[model samples]
Target: MNDKVLIVGAGAIGGFYGGLLAKAGADVSVVCRSDYDVAKHYGYRIDSYALGNWQLMPNQVLRHVSEYQGQPDYLILCTKVTADIDRVTLIRDAVAPCTTIVLIQNGVEIERELQQAFPDNLLVSGLAFICCNRNAPGEISHLAYGKLILGNLSGRQEPKTQYLRDLFLGAGIECVISEDIVASRWQKCVWNAPFNPLSVLSGGLATQAILQNQENFVRRVMREVCSIADACGHPLPADIVENHIALTRDMPPYKTSMLLDFERGHTMETEAILGNAVRAAQRQSVDCPCLESLYVLMQLLELQIRSSSLLN
Candidate 1:
């Protein structure tokens, strides 16, 4: 196996997963934007719930993909899929034919762009079921669960998939090999579509409070997401909604990543998680009232943020 892994966007998800891979003996190189100096000097400090506390100074800290000196085995793109960034373009130069580009990003209908951009190169879709936050430079707080599901968009397992799974598993993390990554994206959207937006719209309420005070609204949004998914030809598991509810009930009272992004005055992932889902529903003529409403609200919020930024 090619033991070298390059982590682009060294923030919460990137730092946590990349730190573990480096700890597991992979030749991991991390590329950071904001925390470049800190990552270069002090390395990453990951306080994981599952893997416990760990730190890494790989000696290969890079500020951008252009600084990478090797043909990487895995170029993991852990950046947030937002309106301001063209994800495919960011990883263009370093994406060799041998590189298995692992996109551990959140969004529906996001894989096609990269797949089209690099047809010959291997693409792996990753879903991170964890509550992690990077409140400051060189620091990652992994608050809760950290299981990862990985698969190609083609709906089949490749040899590379097993290698990636084993790589994460070797790092003392629970990793599952998925069959249909397309469906998996939609499945994740069920929970993401509602809570992420409502958390921000509700004047920054935490997960527990949102569920406690607005259970019915949450359920309705989830059901709408499921319906949209089914119309798009990927029916989710029957009890996934209940599973999310129970998971949230037992989860620590914490702010979501989207909420954190808004709180920190950064761009929230409004379009990827909610906008894409709503657009897909519209194509299939499926009525996603809840999703449509949330998308509009988030767009307005994003606009407000932009206007405020201009004045400052």
Candidate 2:
């Protein structure tokens, strides 16, 4: 029997990955908001640079969680982590007791809340290293790399995690299971801490442009993140910084998800990506001046966005 999967926040990340699971023969359903009409009518159209073009017709297209037909084996949360969104509340109604909750979101130290909320359910933390975006309603463009790292937050090598990995692999997607997913989050943040906010602060610049103009600054921020991770007892790889810089240099010129949210006037993951890391630094007595500065600037930008929204 195919595993039942329900995708919450079917945006770029959710749509792309959920579509892949569908391709792997899972009974994939989506709770769509912005693209509800289009998805309900035509399903999702995915164009991938590596995998090629395809269409994903979800087993169910729902406007809300309560409308889902049955208990899903997996519930994947791919929403942007922001102050304005209460993720647990959004999906509480449909989360069956037996469901494995998977969060494929950005940020360090974001798993605790869900763990607390669903203490009995298995919680998996996941990260997607991909350059994907929704060009229009129900249309996703997979511009570059797409690899997923998943692991149980409890540090156990859960069978479900392996099963999910096998599912992705079956669809020709690279999926790695990690014993320490938290450290992986910090490692990814090494790149996100700099490029994401810098893209916004630079008045809309792509990753390559920001790195080209201010490579030194980018490295400094990444180092600060590494320091915090080490202090928090999740030491990253020794050459993580250089690896990230090299990867960015070779990546296609792309606007980050944060910058894209800013462009669309959507809530950005300022707190999730930068603020949480800064707080972790403070708690561990780690000196992260560069990371702290980025946190403050993003806060101000978020405030400005809120203010503009109120007036307009």
Candidate 3:
């Protein structure tokens, strides 16, 4: 396997995968912010809970984009979807012409934005069904599953894409080179659209919230999102929802990433995660009351949190 991997944003997903790749002897370089210095001084320490692993090392942890050396064969973006586009543009110079840009973000629109920005480069979409958090600098904690789903959203499944898929498979990461990538994305959203913000707003695990407070509301949101998916010609059947509900039931007690951000007083991934489904519902003339209500609730909660933080 090719060892040169450039991992942008050394957070939960980035640190987990990057640490794994490094431990497996891949030449991994994590592109971080000012924390790179401290990480370098100590090490990229990853204390994971789910994978039953921990890693501490110092390979290539660069602070500035200019300090990034060697053209990368793979540029893996593991940031939140709402992160600014300029971050990608900043690292464009470090990528070789043939570098494969893999976006390991939560939402659906990041690939769209990246395609718009880097029209010539190869862009791949990834969806991870895992629970992870960066509780400390240079440290990542995995809480639950670590399966990954990847696809070529542009519909061009090239040899390089196949190679990347094979690489992940060899790394023991479960992945699917989905043919119906759009359907897969939206279907994945069926789970995320409700769970992410609901977890944040209600302070509950997805299954707990679904079973405890509003089981019908959970079903309603899924039904509405599935309707939108069907209207968009990607019908997620009832069996799929049944299977996904089962999967969520198996997950450990973990809050969504948006809730983590909310707890930290940081801006949640509003536009990409929840907002995309809401906008898509509007565009397709599909009324999604649950999604709309959660969106508004989250906006209010964030406003209150920020206002209170500023006052403090």
The list of candidate 1 runs beyond 4 A from truth reads none
Task: Indicate whether candidate 1 or candidate 3 has the larger TM-score.
Answer: 1
Ranking by lDDT: 2, 1, 3
Report the number of the highest-TM-score candidate: 2
User: What pairs collide in candidate 1?
Assistant: none
TM-score of 1: 0.95
1-312 per-residue lDDT for model 2 (tens digits): 789999999998999999999999999999989999999989999999999999999989998899999999999999989888899998898899879999999998998888889899999999999888899999999987899999987789999888999999998889999989999999999999999999998899999999899999999999999999999988999999999999889888989889988898888888998989999998999999988998899888888877988999
Against the correct fold, how does model 2 do in TM-score?
0.97
lDDT of each: 0.88, 0.92, 0.73
Worst 10 residues of 3 by lDDT: 203-212
Task: For model 1, give the 10-residue run with minimal summed lDDT.
Answer: 50-59
Rank order (by TM-score, best first)? 2, 1, 3
